[model samples]
Target: MKQSEIIKRLSDKELKKQVFLSQGLLLIVGVGLSFIFFDTFADWNSIMGWKPKQILFYGVIPGLGIVLLDIFIMRIFPEKHYDDGGINKRIFKNQSIGFIFVLSSLVAISEELLFRGVLQSVFGYLIASILFAVVHFRYFTKPVLLLSIFSISFLIGYLFEVTNNLYVTIAFHFTVDFVLGLIIRFKL
Candidate 1:
């Protein structure tokens, strides 16, 4: 079967919601696995370059970009309120400012540790990045979505590769999520 046919098999709303939930669950599992067996949480200095300014630039900027991107996309496409019951609403209600901050920080920090630090440093960036994109597959619908995720992940991984600083990518991830959270909170 063609890839697009397979992609179309899942309803858009179902795919979006399922992917969002699945990614969250996977993150929890990944963190659990990391803590239980791997001793994954090493000193930040070991993985990141010690530069305070970078946090503002890399973290804050890309984070804002993501939030803005979401707004722009939604403005263009403007999805209707397609809830599968109260599930989506409940999820959003529960996931307010505090939830956004905590989750974003956790994902930003943890994803960097798992993907850039453990996987890339141990195996290779190319392999690790592909894995990262694969895990995020549920978050996107089109093959282009996969391409974007893969590209972004690889670029972030490459930054880590070049700078030997997880801080750079961590900053990027954190900033993106933080801003996105604020956007949601403000209903902007």
Candidate 2:
């Protein structure tokens, strides 16, 4: 499809649902590819290491936690969610500060380890960052947004590089996200 056509499809609720489903399918494809190419879905860990709890807590949960917290905060302080520049239009843009903090911590810990720690270190930062940003492409379109994604990915990479401890980056990520969450929550 042409770019405009693809964009139009994305705007359609049904198409958007399909896109979300396709993303899930793509993640399965990725896991399948990893198993085929690397011989282990765990990337050398036990096969069961790739299970839901590990992936969810390590990745999706923490980030989502902060996001939800932000939403709760926004219920009280609506202005907290608004970008003065009005650029943020992601689903969680109206989230509360508490929600953002929890989500940030989650993203920092899980995303850093997943992207920078696992993917970047194993493959390369450029590739991993691109993939990371791509997975989140629904949240933004501007070049600046992409740049921001890359910047955050690099910062996470730096944390991993400096300490070689996934938890280090996780901690840093958690702290940053926690702070952002709080800022959004209380409007402080």
Per-candidate TM equals 0.65, 0.47
Maximum-TM-score candidate: 1
Q: Tell me the tens digit of each residue's lDDT in model 2 across 28-132.
A: 555454555564534434322334444444434544554565456446555533332232233234566655655555455456555655576568757876787
What's the CA error at residue 1 for candidate 2, in Å?
Answer: 15
Cα RMSD for candidates in order: 6.4, 8.6
lDDT of 1 by residue, 37-98 (tens): 45535644566667777656665566577657656655765353211232323333435577
Q: Compare the candidates by lDDT and give the number of the best one.
A: 1
lDDT to native, each model: 0.64, 0.52
